[model samples]
Target: MKQRAQGSAGAGTPPGDARVPAQPRPADAPDGFRERDTAVPAARAARGEHTHSERPIPEPRPAVQRSSVRGQILDALRTALVTGELKPGEVYSGPVLGDRFGVSATPVREAMQQLALEGAVEVVPNRGFRVVERGARELAELAEVRALIEVPVMLRLARTVPGERWTELRPLAEETVRAAGTGCPATYAESDRAFHRALLALSGNEQLVGIAADLHRRSQWPPVRRGRAYLVADAAEHMALLDALISGDVDGVRGLVSQHFAGAG
Candidate 1:
């Protein structure tokens, strides 16, 4: 009998036989045991081709949805608070607010928690949240604190921040005037804060801006019973301050800012 050639299947099998079984590819492998295609990736890398995996990355949809819902709820609650719909010193349950806002209790509770942090509400155990009752004394104290912080900063900036920077703030000042003319306290309050924030931002001190903004919001929370004339006057003060700053009139800026906070108190 003829001796089989090396590596032959058997004596009867021819060289390079058609019936020989081939190695399994990655696609043909069973679940949990699929082989990785190392060669194709290497080839692709050498060719400068992208070899990213085809699987899609999962997103945290539920958490994102909940966050958006919570933000909307918080904004609605703030609007209600500003409009005096959520009366000061009144305790309201999360579910009750949720019904009013057409949402579930969870988002409302989350929003109330934020409001508590902002000093707009106080959490009551086993109950819900109480809208914080801010009296005139508190408003006056907030104004005093704000003046102590912002007046010196504005004066210093008025000397150094340059005419162009002060000019840049004119639009924000004008926006406050427009908001004030709307006769809506909430609108004017927000615009008033924006104008101050823009001015403080020129000082390039983020901490100061944040602190002033918080104090300003706290002061504005007590609903203003004053008429539109008060809002208009307040808006005019912003423009006057801008003019003083642009003209390099430190004394004028000082007087305007002091009077502004005095009126606020």
Candidate 2:
């Protein structure tokens, strides 16, 4: 038998020895990844979406008397989640979100804690948080809850509030329908939220308004796409509810709200 080469593999010396030299990485390898990171901003510029450094980055605005950076981050996160930018069931870290918001992880974490309380996300120990998935069943349950709360309030308002007050809100309600008619989801969502908020504001209970607003925002999770005809039908329903309130038909208002919730689900 031929003798093994000297120093190649003495007994007990493993093949592919630990002392083997590492091959040089290619020029396009991840070793120089930061240089390639600029491509994203360049592409955004091409598409007319200016990069952060291109535009003036303003300092965060003051909230009430003090600067609440955590609140701002929470609001931003909520917007992102509602718009489907932060997809349901996908995990996101504080550092990653902090980088996106141009803030620190501390505020991002604080905001995430609030989101956990709202049932918008679930925290994963040692990992991060993920947006909660809301299925059709969950949405239907929310609609039911909304009907239970809103129908009674609307009934009272119809009986007590003057008819002219509802008529005055006609323009705003119509604007919401117009927004839906335009087929812009964001516009319709905001206008729809505004309409509900305005209606609830008449209650003169800030706490009630806040709770209803939270439910309204939550119900919008996983937005469903309906045809223009559907939107028109929904708008008509809103108008009918207003008419019932104007006519002081408490029974009619209740019936209309029930029908609206049924149709919505």
Candidate 3:
């Protein structure tokens, strides 16, 4: 995994700190999530790495590693799509996103193809890809499907999975809360996806888990724009849902799951 800043500022630091170096993407990180730059050029300057007559070391720009460039670009696009940066029905060229991440168009095209398969974007011949618009009806349908698939599965897990097994998943829930607290759209979106994915994985049904994860990703398109209070409440609901499951309250879990979908719709 690569270390990077987890804020919503994207690759760059907050404005008014132009000299701050851009954090470099790590070679092995799958998710191209950006983080605050830990590089300290000032310390180097104090060590005489630069003087008044010489210029400071240039900040490294955000980029994808060649070994996993396509995957990272896909991750970046997912974040952008989730945060509504990639607006629905808006066509975007590979060169444009490539330039944004300081990478080449090949990986961007590859990534866009994957997003196309996910139904998040449609490829435009002789041009680029356009983000698919998700209407209210589409969202409602998605929520319905999720409720249909997940509710029973969760209820059964609550009955079958031991309390200790569920307890071990507390950390994932806690991480989701921490990400929600940060209000970083990408981080929170991914963490929220992760928490649910892990919970469903307890069913030991890979096919079901994959389907649920896909639905989860689609649900995140045009991600929640609500502020911290909403996210905090959302996180709390996740914990509450977990508690219901851990306590083997099948009825409570079913109701909570239904309520969650209702709220999502």
Leading candidate by TM-score = 1
Instruction: Write one digit per residue (lDDT tens) for candidate 2, span 26-95.
Output: 4776654554366555555656677887868676555431338888898788778756788998999999
C-alpha positional error of residue 248 in candidate 1 after TM-score superposition, expressed in Å:
0.9
TM-score-wise, the better of 1 and 3 is: 1
Q: In model 3, state the lDDT of residue 261.
A: 82
Q: Model 1 over residues 1-265: C-alpha lDDT tens digits?
A: 2445644546556444423333356665665752234555555555555778545558779989999999999877877787788899999999998888898999999989988999999999999999999888888999899999999999999889889988988999999999989988878877888899999998889999999999888887758687889889989989998999999999999999999999997
**Against the hidden true structure, what lDDT does model 1 obtain?**
0.85
* Separate clash counts for every candidate: 0, 0, 4
Per-residue lDDT for 74 in model 3? 88
lDDT of 2 at 244: 84
Cand. 2 TM to true fold: 0.67
What's the TM-score of each model vs. the native?
A: 0.78, 0.67, 0.73
Question: In model 3, how large is the Cα lDDT of residue 139?
Answer: 84
Which residue pairs clash in candidate 2?
none
lDDT of 3 at 212: 94
Stretches of model 2 off by over 4 angstroms after superposition: 1-68, 225-229
Query: Where does candidate 1 stray beyond 4 Å?
Result: 1-59
